[model samples]
Structure formats: structure tokens, C-alpha cells
Target: MSRAGCSACVRAQEQLAQILADYDLRLAVVDVDQLAEQGDPLPRAEFGDRLPVIVLNGVEHGYWEVDEKRLRADLDALR
Candidate 1:
């Protein structure tokens, strides 16, 4: 989950983009603010405090930043 104008979120997305292709993974960026405007505020309510929440495989992997080393390890394990 993320929000507009979040520097951390932009950085996280850039970081993910750099590696996702290596693992044949696709990223889906969910804007919490957009969700709220669309009548679904659960994500924002649950993780509003965390601007750049990283969710991998439907489970939250981390927040604030993208732990590339850890994430790469997790992706390898998935294989």
C-alpha cells in the first residue's frame, strides 16, 4: 500500500522495478488514498501510518523501505 506524493513509496517502487524482472514477478501498486475515494478505506485505516508498505504474495513483507536483500532471499525461497 502507498499514497500519493510519498518519497519513500517512489523509492520503493523504483527499487522493486529494478529486481522484479529477475524473478519474473509483477508488481501491483495500490494507492490507499484512491481506495478511500472509491469507498474502500480498510487498507488506509489498517496501514495509513505506513506510507510505503510492501506486500508480497498478499502478505505484508515490510514497511517504510524495500529491503532488497531480504526480499531477494524470499523470492529465491519461493522458487
Candidate 2:
């Protein structure tokens, strides 16, 4: 996630939330700028200004947008 209020990020987050509503998912919003300011591992260097990055199991799943179909496929596989 980005602190710059990226529109795409916001939309993706909302879409993901709706998609995973039926499942038990632990979604977190990480402000890259804040993380950088705090010297966290998730800095802009890695994530950059790309808003609404989806990370699963410590690996990036998607960025800028939520691939709903792909996400559903992944979740189905998890089940």
C-alpha cells in the first residue's frame, strides 16, 4: 500500500476485501512511505510507489491492481 492515496491502490484493496469476504484472510495495509520512514524492511526501494501491492506468504502476488480471477484461482487452490 501507499500513503500517497493512490486511486488504483484504494480500488484494488476494496476489490480484494470483497473477494475474500467469504474466506478467512489476513490482509494488511502497509504504507511504504511510513515503513521507509521507520527503516522497516518494506521500503520504497523494494515496493516503490506502486500502490496496492498484494503480498502473499512474504512474496509479492500482484501490484497496482487485484487480478480477481487469479486471486480466486489461488484461493480455490488453497482450499
Off by over 4 Å in 2: none
- Cα deviation in Å at residue 27, candidate 2? 2.2
Candidate-wise lDDT, in order = 0.91, 0.77
lDDT of 1 by residue, 1-79 (tens): 8899998999989889888989878778999999999999899998989879999889999999899999999999999
Q: Highest TM-score, which number?
A: 1
Candidate 2, residues 1-79, lDDT tens digits: the string is 6556678777877888888886777567888888888878556777776667888667788888888888888888889
The most accurate candidate by lDDT is 1
